[model samples]
Target: MASRRIPKAAGCSPIRAVLAGPAENVITEKLILKPAPETKTEVVQKNTSVHNDNWFELMAINHLSEKLQAATGVKSMKSGYESLVEATAMVSKIYNPKRQQELVIQCLDSAIPKIILNMIKTLLPQTQFTREYFAAFTTVFFTWLIGPSEVRESEFNGRREKNVVHVKKCRFLEQSNCVGMCINLCKMPSQAFIKDTLGMPVNMVPNFEDMSCEMIFGQEPPASNDDPALKQPCYKSCRAIQKHTAKCSS
Candidate 1:
């Protein structure tokens, strides 16, 4: 996969304020409102060009797929992103929303050994450094899923912090096309894993308008009822409505 390098701290850009957290904040959330979903979700699939994934990226994808298989107790013959998505679909089918999220977290816990998580939690104490470091880390390492991204600055506590990752276009979102999958499968689980495992909260703000997103490290996510992302309707081409369909609004 083609990836962009995170620029140095001096090169960080302070863009317009567009983010919200659990607490009241100066920045506001920028979300493109969509029509409310029907009881059924429409899952869509698009034929996109294949990515030239490197060995490391392939290894990461394979490891994650294995972890998901182990968690869901279902084996997949597909490889790369397909296998992971298949496993995720199984997870959505086999459990409630809460349990699905928990199972994904458990998969993450298995994918990443507890020793590393403990070391990170012990060394990084939810400070500005930890947040920025994670932002940069995500930029470098998460390209296999999120596609190319860059580290940007966001206003936090009246100061600019380079703790935001601006995804140019999310590979997962574009591939799945279903907003429900983006939320239940990727967004919610990711936020929970980072906060619970790393001891640093992150709010993943995905812009359905263009499939771009922002990962605001150190910002606590809003409740489900208050989160606009959860309410977003599936794309017109959503195919999940036929396969692995669940409560899209939930």
Candidate 2:
């Protein structure tokens, strides 16, 4: 009881004690506790980096679409699908499949640059011409130019290869609905582009049943006589087949 008088309330609050200390130290401590401005900046930069190519992608698509239109003689972009098929049929009527392939190659050759070819050449050795590299390139480049496709990797011939690009529903095929057009226009030219131009062998297999197709990269194509793609019958929905009332053969 003698000292029962409670110790006077702490002479100063803890905050006051801190405030009473060196102003510079207090300011430094506050700054240390506060979040850095760069933290917010870094988050913004990361998001922007991922989305940096909007204009570039748009430009690329526009350029490719224009080239396709020019090559196919399709004046209107609105009717690109129909025009592409019509143009293919016209070409098929005028030229043999082999010649059609050469024309398509010439068109593509002009559009894609020597620099890109050189880059591919440089990277091909580094990548060992693996299926994954080619598949990735196809997805990023070809799909953007054409339509959607999926890359499926599997073991073949005693090696793992991401060699297949599965087009679940091809825009060209759906619009054309003709087996001959698929072979002459898309399949043959694509094979030639990949194999002869890009130096990667590929065989394009079109399945008309579901309007799906598989582009098998890194594989040699069979002879036309032995190829099932050559043997495919015209789709029931083919306009030519319907109009002519005739079956299509290789």
Candidate 3:
């Protein structure tokens, strides 16, 4: 018998396929806006790009700054972090290498506390719907929830970290027919608006009509069709027939 060739085992985690397509191609509850596969979403909508870029820059600075902070704890003199060599050399005070390593290790281990991570995950649900706005939201939500972290404030006392980066409105150019965009945005399910924008017969959805608001959710509907706001065009359409009219009235 011929010898059989054995195939190599795959890595434990499967790699995701890269998306390669135009920027306009997006799938959302709203319209399908396409986006280029390779482009970061930050680039597609340039107005939103500025705020998003700050996040990426901040994350990058974090890597470099970690060494600077850790270096302070290092009682010893050397650094093996090659990527940071230039940045480190600028402010690195020579210390005993062994003591520094111990401090660095201890500082790293205790850097991210569990309480903050739990708070972050709780407030920021990792979902497609809110991903675009999550980082900015995380900043806003944290300040609202627990106020500032004592350590961060105490360390950088005078200089304030600006969490609220200004995000500008995307006023797309007049080049394309924005009619489609306008109509789509005006549709219901904005998630922000609780009441139906359509004012569609609530009955359109299954069983929504059969049960009155009061019956279903223990909340009363408008008392009378005469109420100006609740009075819909449907009332006028059927108003020809009086509810109290006799059959002989015909």
What ranges in model 2 sit over 4 Å off? 1-83, 126-129, 144-146, 240-250
Best-performing candidate as measured by lDDT: 1
Off by over 4 Å in 1: 1-50, 245-247
The order by descending lDDT is: 1, 2, 3
Order of quality (TM-score): 1, 2, 3
RMSD of each: 23.8, 16.1, 32.3
Find the candidate with the highest TM-score and give its number: 1
lDDT of 3: 0.27
Error of 3 at 82 (Å): 18
Overall lDDT per candidate, in order of appearance: 0.82, 0.63, 0.27
Model 3 steric clash total: 20
lDDT of 2 at 53: 31
Tens-place lDDT digits, model 1, residues 1-250? 2334554567687444444444655567798999886432221133353577899998999898898898889888899988887777667667777877888888888888899999999999988898999999999998997889999999999999999999987888877666777888789999999898889999999988777899999999999899989888877666465677755554
* TM-score for each candidate, following the candidate numbering: 0.78, 0.64, 0.18
